[model samples]
Target: MHLFELTCTAYFKNDLDFRRSFETISHFITYAMMRGGLDERHTKSGYKHYVFGGLLPLEADKVYKKGSTYRFILRSPDEEFLTALSTALRQNIDHPDFIVVETHLNRRKSFFITELYSATPVIVTSEGNLFWTMEKNGDIMQLQRQLHDNLEKKYQSFYGEEIKAPQNFIQMIEIKNRVPQNIEIHKEGKKIRFFGNKFRIVPNEDEMSQKLAFTALACGLGEKNSYGGGFCLAGGMR
Candidate 1:
């Protein structure tokens, strides 16, 4: 499979509380997509087939400085969509909160990925319930099953192929922050809330395993990906 990455550098126009900035970033992306004549994709139903990360310069204070350049990433297996997004972001250079100063796009083969890290929290859900911790689920095995199943479904949906008998694709490395992070977004005049956890993940050193990791990195790990949940970073590829 093929994957595309877009990195955006912007100058913050105001002091933004990074802790609660996902909503703002989501809107910014939607607006850019709309401006790029992707109104249907911006408003259409079902999976958006793309994912995004939060603003860069990870800070403890959770506040961003005004006029400082910060970076964020967006990835997808759809190159056409990403190309339009890049063009739209570049054309609409100014915004009330930030200015899109630069954007870089790179395409890569999915198999080139050697490492995958969740740059944003991954929201895994089962039977309309959010899976935040193992304690809530009663065991780690159940959580692992849910995570793998979720990724497997996403992989099938994205590629239109089912993975045959295989080992676990995503190997949990570490949960950087154990606490659940809350993501609230305004949709249709109502506020929707979701909880997720940020963690690092690697593959099982097999081709199929890496393909699954790349699916998560390219598309997203769990639900609400268009809102930036499950955004991850793939490394060790040149």
Candidate 2:
């Protein structure tokens, strides 16, 4: 099933910037979902979004690119839709997080991804629990820094190597939020770049959108149902 059903509903707080609020959204959510499963009938400015596979839906979303793009705006919720939304979120966590466009941030009449935010899924296990983050941009950056510092502390406490830049982190909690700020294709034509964060692209000739959407789904990107089933709160990234 498409991760989000239209029944989802969600809220957007005014960001650190006072002029506007995070875009409102509603959609169904599926975790660790693979995009090759969905339908890619939709196209964004000539890109395939959702395409159909046998029984599953191929993913349609991808990290936003500056020129080639797939963009949608999150609109405010009206009364009736808002009420029905409360029941929807409990069905799953996908309805709560989204990499939606914000108007004020874009500072334009049309949509642009001026902001990137998500409410990702978390499964607590013995290794350590993981959680989604909703932080002011600065805070998120700081938390990333702390992760590096904590790594250093651990190394120093045990290993004796001199401190250096942290190693690349393995990608988890996929976010095809913003399109890559840069791109490069290799021998097999696989490409990689950044959305709100860094990512790699798999190659596919037949269905371009399908390829991108699959990338998004694999990375756990897209809109969520607003019913609030999987709402996550991080320990402040900053």
Candidate 3:
């Protein structure tokens, strides 16, 4: 098992609103995965220890590729899930965000990125996390702006246009022992706020979205969706 410790850096207001918004983003991932016809499952240990999401038990001998564009080899998973994820990613209208079967942690950067896909349009990276289908190649940083706008709109829809997130809750991680702390989690109006900065918030729904992503991961569902950060999912999980 991996050892994780919370990095106390950022802050959130309260647990109520934090939980609400956090859950919202996670559900979107669940919807996308269901649209791909897959399920996720997981078991929880304490508040931080989650078993079997990205790291699962599967065969490693399987080999596959997508023309000269990509080569995929599985260390654990079989063929079906990879196929679904590949198809979903390659079929992107805006830059498609696909994932590799085996994910490696960049110890140097203290972050993780997927294995390479060939013939990739070589679009420059951005801050937000947006991209295009071969031709569009929009920057992710710009997408972050878009996500922020969409989130604000979403919040306004329910909380009124006057609803603005408090400055205290910044989407960033404070890593100590490779674990993040002070995560800003939200579910509806009630949010889960923290005082430390162990958690890093990538631009997106963040806490909630990651939960849903973890939800999909647990269910073994694969599809195209904007994903950020390592997270845990327990909703509708088995």
Which structure among the candidates has the greatest lDDT? Answer: 1
Q: Kindly provide the TM-score of model 2 when superposed on the true structure, using C-alpha atoms.
A: 0.18
lDDT of each: 0.78, 0.25, 0.26
State each model's C-alpha RMSD to the native.
2.5, 20.4, 19.5
Clash number for model 2? Answer: 34
Scored by lDDT, model 1 comes in at: 0.78
Q: Which stretches of model 1 miss by more than 4 angstroms?
A: 112-115, 171-173, 188-191, 235-238
Writing each residue's lDDT as its tens digit, candidate 1 over 1-238 gives 8889999998888988875578878888888887789999878766788988888877678897887888988889999999888889888556788878789999977566666777777787755475566446545555566667777777787778998528777556666775777678777998878877776766677777777777888888777888889888777655
Estimate, for each residue in 79-124, the C-alpha lDDT of model 3 and write its tens digit: 3444443343233222122222222211111122111111101111
Candidate 2: regions farther than 4 A off: 1-72, 75-128, 131-196, 200-202, 206-238
Candidate 1, poorest ten consecutive residues by summed lDDT: 134-143
lDDT of 2 by residue, 194-214 (tens): 113332222122332232222
Worst 10 residues of 2 by lDDT: 49-58
TM per model?
A: 0.86, 0.18, 0.23
Per-residue lDDT of 136 in model 3: 47
Candidate 3 lDDT score at position 185? 43
For TM-score, the strongest prediction is 1
